[model samples]
Target: MRKSKSFSARTLDANALKSFAHPLRLRIYELLDERGPATATGLAALLGENTGATSYHLRELARHGMIEVAAGMGRGKEKYWRVVPGGFTYGDAPPDAEAASALEVLLDDLVRQRGSELARWREGASRAPAEWVEASGFGRRSLRLTVEETAELRDQVLEVLERYRTVADGRQAEAAEEGRDPSTGHVVIHFDVLPLGAVPEDEAAGQEADPAGQEAGPA
Candidate 1:
């Protein structure tokens, strides 16, 4: 059985990327996922968009399975919207040209979002609680490992994050049952795992030997 308190994710294929590449749809999904649920009107106000535009995008997102009809009614008894239980994962580079284009759009949006978040934190962190300021950080480290070892390390890191989320979700549920608000505001964590240095010696030699469109290239 799937873990109730932890998140689940689906890997997006080429076709799925087509429907999820829109800017408004991406923003709507993020808002719904982060902040429980909201009506199109409410989302429009929060996003500074018109209600009609928000409603249209919401419908599109629902059609793509990114959002669903949330419980409770809104103004005019219209349905509220919330994100699906799990999120999506896609590779930076997909084989299909269309999918790659969509991934590019998403990555560009993510870059802007990350910059905005960092700016907000930098401007406000000093005045915030000492504990929070101390806990928040950014760092980089270099590690040398074989491909299999690298994959193992990545899995371990993901497992650790899932465990923490599970614990937090359980506590939130308990707080809700006790009739107390459990929210402590939103916190976003970003992880980057990328190769930064030169290619492996064997691969480099292979490429040098065949500098044409013949032999298979290093992935």
Candidate 2:
């Protein structure tokens, strides 16, 4: 499996999210998210769909700039597709409407992806590198920190995740070289950096400081 590029959740534009509303589209994006690039035929096998079906979905994704043909992978008929890496920073639809439903689909894809990644990790656990195997786990804890401090902690967590994320793909080949892992099963280690706050549920609810002061609290 290819290493996934970690995204800091961003507002996904309605157009972008809508483009991905199709089940096949979500599957294609998720496949690329976990397995890196592949041709239509290869993706079909992985998705249990016909090559034409996969090809059409991939083309749709390519049209939306969700996936791009990897450069220099090979010559003819070996196009590769990849997910665009960034937090969703474009969706402006209301939370309880049609577009919101679309956004939910995208979010569901993300949650499903975490499940797929976990399953793949377990299946390959024994065949993976000791360091990779050792570096894996699901962790959680309550934390006490000011809002800004919590934001800082989140950024720090993302930074560390970025540093380790390079190990999966060669985007940061130098970092990959520094963290030597014995060659073994191809893996993208999942690290859930969930920082649960210790604040009261009501206080946490009041922590809604949307950029525009619209105050959209967590429901």
Candidate 3:
């Protein structure tokens, strides 16, 4: 049976990235997923786009099963949109070259956004001194858990992050809620976990003894 939760949310895992591949669909999914429920007009307003355009994109998303109509948000006449409850996953869906391309497109948009900001900073616009500036990423070698444990850990972190997904410090309050590019600026959390190749002989040299009390090495 599926896990139950409020927010009428769908718990997604490996299928999320695939469903989120389309550009407009991804944006619409994010909007509906994050902001609760919205209408086509509301989505367009939040995205600075035409309502018709938003509606067309939403139809496409629905057709592809990336989103679904949320309950209790609409009356008889008005229409509403929302992400399917727990309606996403990460890697469960079938492999799609289109989805991979869509991911590349999303990554490019992120890079372009960062580049735009860097350009602004380089223009000598001494905005309030950088509050935080650091980039750190490293590969690690460690394996002490099964696949189930790894999934649990990832889910736990995601749940915690969702709690603060809309947190703000007063500046551009709406930006935080609506997920727009902040007029001042905003922070990003780029967390990733990927599998690496098997451990090498050099690194294995540092491990402590195994259960048999012998130096840790390939059994």
Q: lDDT score, residue 40, model 2?
A: 88
- What is the clash tally of candidate 2? 10
Best by lDDT: 1
lDDT for model 1, on a 0 to 1 scale?
A: 0.71
Task: Estimate the overall C-alpha local distance difference test score of candidate 2.
Answer: 0.63
Candidate 3, residues 1-219: lDDT per residue as tens digits?
121242223433333445555567766766665565689988998899898999898877676566667544567856776554333333322356666555555555545544554565556445445543323222344667766776676667566655554343222234335555534433444444443334675656544434465533211
Q: State every prediction's TM-score relative to the real structure.
A: 0.74, 0.64, 0.44
Candidate number achieving the greatest TM-score relative to the actual structure: 1
lDDT, candidates in the order shown? 0.71, 0.63, 0.54
The per-candidate count of clashes, in order, stands at 0, 10, 17
TM-score of 2: 0.64
What are the RMSD figures for all models against the true structure? 7.4, 8.7, 12.4
Q: After superposition, how far is residue 99 of candidate 2 from its true place, in Å?
A: 2.4
Q: How well does candidate 1 score on lDDT at residue 117?
A: 77
